[model samples]
Target: MRFRNLLLSAATCAAISLSASADLTGKVTFSGKAPEPKQIDMSGVKECADKHPDPVFEQTLVVGEKGELANVVVSIKAEDSPDLKGEPSKDPAVLDQKGCMYEPHVLAMCVGQPLVVKNDDEFLHNVHSLAQENPNFNFGQPNKDDGKTVDQAPKTKEYIRIKCDVHPWMSAYIAVFENPYFAVTGEDGTYAIKGLPDGDYTVQFWHEKLASTPVEAKVTIKDGKGELNHEFKAEGAMAPDTSDVKLASMTKTSEKSCCEMSKKVEKVATATPAAKPADAQVKAAN
Candidate 1:
């Protein structure tokens, strides 16, 4: 009985030790004065305008109270760290549109993982993705509480920009990675990428405004968790263009009709030929 109890205690200790090695935590900070927030003119759509009684601002550069920067994608560039292997999560990554604004302005997900795009507003929203390496799509969700799960897995590491046709101001960025070792900085400018095996890695910090040049650092995780911090300046970073990204003017009555028509078309495209369910399951299981 004593020997069995000792074995059980050893197993419990091993489980605790394994859990400790799975975490990677860090913070991203800003070095320069944050750019003045850009004003978003929602006057084009009355419903969207009314939803925001307060003046809405563009999230071009979201710097926290401290020098912390939010929405930065901290990832282990797969090519640079070939030995690092991360399994994608079973649950799908979400990109929600609420109040005519995309919540979590920046998103990072593993390549081939399910991306669930949702619209939570009462008005029409068009989810148009501009991706070079992956299949590009432009579709609308006409009603409230509508969602579309897209399996348009990217063939390479890329950044896909999502825009709304009905609302010209709405835009978001999705950073697709080959591996699952990535995290987007939160409000406090902090990020955590858990479940990484102990090894040397090349960690890349990417932000929408600084896509042309990403900051890279070498980190060695000896005991499971590796801490990293990066600082970006506002001066060198390029802000996103606010001009019309091929948006055509529409009459109020025709807008709803247009959205509904596109929504139906997209539903057919994504529904019938169901994406590789078996592949996604196998990848997640690994």
Candidate 2:
């Protein structure tokens, strides 16, 4: 009986040790004044323009009134962190297109995790991926609530750019990491990376406008928690041009009409028979 009690106690202690982990939390702030957001012109597409009664501005740099910076990618460097085993989550990260713009200007996901691109608009929008390390994909979504699951996940770590060819001003970024210790700053500029083992790590903070320069910080995690705060200088930072100078005139064909035409063409092609070879035709005639 005494030996049995000792074994049970050992097992319990091992389980508790295995589950010991910590979280890294931080906030990113802007130091100087931010640039004025550029207003986007959606007059070329009347349907899209009508959806927004007020003017929409570019999201290149979103800073709150209190200098909270949003859309910054925060992650722990893979080299400083231990390797993660097993597969990533099967649940997909979703990116939605609404009001002629991409929601959540920045997205972060573990390598090999699934991704779903959704269209919440009633008009046509093409998803074009400008990926250097991963395969590029471009497809059109013409109906409302159209969702497409990407065939494969990114195999390498990279920052992929997504764009809508139809909408010249539509753009977003996707940050892929080998490890799962990454988070994007929200409107409040806060982020938390959970489940990190107790150790020293190097954290990285990246922004789109500040692509040329990324800030790094060293942090030591103990006792299940670590806190970090960084401030980005905003001087000489320029926002991207959001004007629709290259927008063409709107097309007359509606989404429904276009879809119906495509279905009819596909059905006709499948039902049609192939022509006989010329030699067989000549033999039959003879």
Candidate 3:
């Protein structure tokens, strides 16, 4: 009887050890000024003219905090999260290129899952896979019908890239992972990954800018729930456009409809010698 009791105690201790392991948790907040908005060349973007109407740029709707924090991919490489999701989804993540932009700019998919790239616009696009861990790929496709869907998949690319030949402005990148334990921060700058094994792990924060070396930290979780607070403070992670990155000018411009805005500004300047007052300009810049 004593031996039997000892074995049961050992089993319980093993279970406790697994559950008692530390769980890392935290949040990532942007602590720097947003990059300046870039000036998109309206003449270049509107090549098709009548076929595609000029898009209107809505700063508030298109960008968040001048894109300082939104769409940042934060993940935990715990290899354990993959065990939680029932086999990978059969349906591929469909990314479409329409009107010189990639729909769903941010995408996350598990390893081995198929990814479909479709050119919904009236021009050709290239799926340029910029992957260091996986294989590299770059291929072009002609635009099909508006409803046509392309059966495109990249087997290897730690992270993939897709660009358009007809529209240099069109671009998209896929954050591919072997496991499904990942998330992209929303406009509010909050992220959560459920189904973690209730333990401690390193959480990685990555951003297009202000994020270098994958700001990492040990997060402690409580009661099967973990909250991580992290700050990505890299000063020049994205690196200022020292080499004329096409956007060396304005900065974080989006392609909705800024050309029309330029027209308004030009018109106002022409009509009135006194442009917006310096104080008003300062207020507007803010």
Top lDDT: which candidate number? 2
Query: What lDDT is reached at residue 217 by model 3?
Result: 39
TM-score of each candidate structure, all chains considered together: 0.75, 0.75, 0.62
Candidate 3 per-residue C-alpha lDDT over 43-146 given as tens digits, one digit per residue, 9 for 90 to 100: 65454333355443312112346333555566664442333332345556667665556666767666566667676666666756545455555667666534
lDDT of 1: 0.62
Q: Give the TM-score of candidate 2.
A: 0.75
For candidate 2, give the lDDT of residue 114. Answer: 84
Give the higher-TM-score candidate: 1 or 3. 1
lDDT of 1 by residue, 1-87 (tens): 343233223321011233434556678777667777789998888888888999998885788889777888877767766644444
Pairs that collide in candidate 1 are none
Tell how far residue 153 is off in model 1, in angstroms: 3.8
Ranking by lDDT: 2, 1, 3
lDDT of each: 0.62, 0.64, 0.45
C-alpha RMSD by candidate, in order: 16.0, 22.7, 15.3
